[model samples]
Target: MSDAQTDPPRQRRERKQNADKRRRQVLDATYRSIVSNGLQRTTLATVAAEAGLSQGVAVFYFKSKKGLLSEALRDLYLIYEAHWQEAVEAAGDDPAAQLVALVKADFDPKICNPAILSVWFAFWGEQKFTPQYGEITREFDDNRQRAIQGICARMLPDDPEHAADVADWVDTLTDGYWQNLHLFPASYSNRRACNSTLRALAALMPEYRDQLTPAD
Candidate 1:
């Protein structure tokens, strides 16, 4: 009832909001720094500068360089996963359409923007040295593979093994696209990559192609 007690509660709420804001700012700054300078050159000071905060402030939220990097990678994974989910949903009830949507989603510039792509490569480059990086990368890979497998299974129920084969095929194609995008810009245009993936999927399920339509 007293001013002191009420003030403490109000202050706590304000602090919580401020902390959340700061955490987001730090994560975003870390992402941008990794995108611009590559993860090897990204530092707390550099990220802090990007966030318009002091290095101490960045450390206050993330604790250490490794912690900052991990959180940034987690954020990136979450965003990527969400995009995949949306793509799956947009595919509607048709399994064939869903497969196409899945392939198209990967190359969508809105979802796989340059910054996100750069940060992804940076994380991939660091996975060799960081155990957590490997763990997170595997988690993403497994989840994606499973999702693709599930879609294939629904589309080709009569051939369960074919579903897995499709999943593996798509995975390989996706990786190839990523590599080409990183290495050869002209050869891996987004439209070309997406179309290639769709064609590959169509080849895998030629019988279902006529039934499938472009996802809304």
Candidate 2:
């Protein structure tokens, strides 16, 4: 018999909520551990210690280090995807506004902080050895690319090839900015990176230059 079957409805709801809270705590600790210790050095014990939970509890929730790390990657992707999706939605139906929103979303503090970037690169560094990491990252990349491509297509209806190319360039530009921000934080600000990306986008698609002007 399951715990839910034996427990009262209120008790079951509380139990599930508590379980979710603990699980999220573990994942947050996992990100900190990755940022502080690197991916290979992060152990279940370390994460549990960081979360103020037991190693056994970590195992119970995630089964193994691989399971824990995979879920962490998925969680990060979900956070990233949600930010961009919300940005696009808030930009209304204008493709230009949506494109700008998507670009700006990459620099949002919640998704682009040093700890999150560290965790992301840590997973990316292990993609060759970890197939699931590659799978998760590929999905992330594909989804973003499709969104960019769709927006570009809407803005440049007669030139589908150019739309695709601009989408690819925008993705690459955002990635380059992330790499620089991660490695050269002392010299780079998110503002500069975002403005530079917008400039590059305007140069690529001069038709949208008015709409793609970098905010001051």
Candidate 3:
């Protein structure tokens, strides 16, 4: 056998790892392109250029522009999920505290960037025409709603219905923030939004109202 064919199995495994790493690098570059230029302008060649890889090498991993976009969206969701987990953990033991922490993290500059937000909105706009995008978007939205519902359940055990209601209400408020961030930056101040959301949820559950109130 030729020297290339004589390589050990471990060498083959290492090659696979390298390939996967390159694929991820390409995905990250594609994400940045989509964020900066929008999906319409993010061609495969553009992503390849961003990744500093040859176009043929990018095509080997992604196959098509759509495939690259799909992978990039999935990667973005995974990154956000990790951030969400960290925010939840930092909130400590109190469910009310957790709820407030989660809301604040949504608008925290460290956690939320214009590029990330722009990519999300772009994917959301394309969801209507793209079945894969639609499915992923629905899953993402449902997961977020479920997280809020779980937090509400913990905070308002006696009033389960109120828990769901409060969760939905908070979702509405956060969604509004996403819509008006550029138009009314001051209107969506993280601290004020968090307090207002907590207050609104508290009104729905008198049993937890005092617990959710900020300390003087």
Per-model CA lDDT versus the true structure:
0.82, 0.92, 0.79
Backbone clashes in model 1, listed as residue pairs:
none
TM-score of each: 0.88, 0.97, 0.82
Cα error of candidate 3 at position 30, Å: 1.4
- Indicate which candidate wins on TM-score: 2
How many pairs of residues in model 3 come into backbone collision?
0
Clash tally, candidates in order = 0, 0, 0
| Model 2 clashes, total count | 0
Give me the runs in candidate 1 sitting further than 4 Å from their true place: 1-14, 211-216
For residues 1-216, what per-residue lDDT tens digits would candidate 1 score against the true structure?
A: 865467878787897899999999999999889878889889999999999999999889889999999988888888889998898898788877777777888888976656677778878987889999999888888898888888889878889988888879987998788778877876668887777777767777888755432332
lDDT of 2: 0.92
Q: Can you tell me which runs of candidate 2 are displaced by over 4 Å?
A: none
Best by lDDT: 2
What range of 10 consecutive residues in model 1 has the weakest lDDT sum?
207-216
lDDT of model 3, residue 178: 68
Residue 51 lDDT in candidate 1: 97
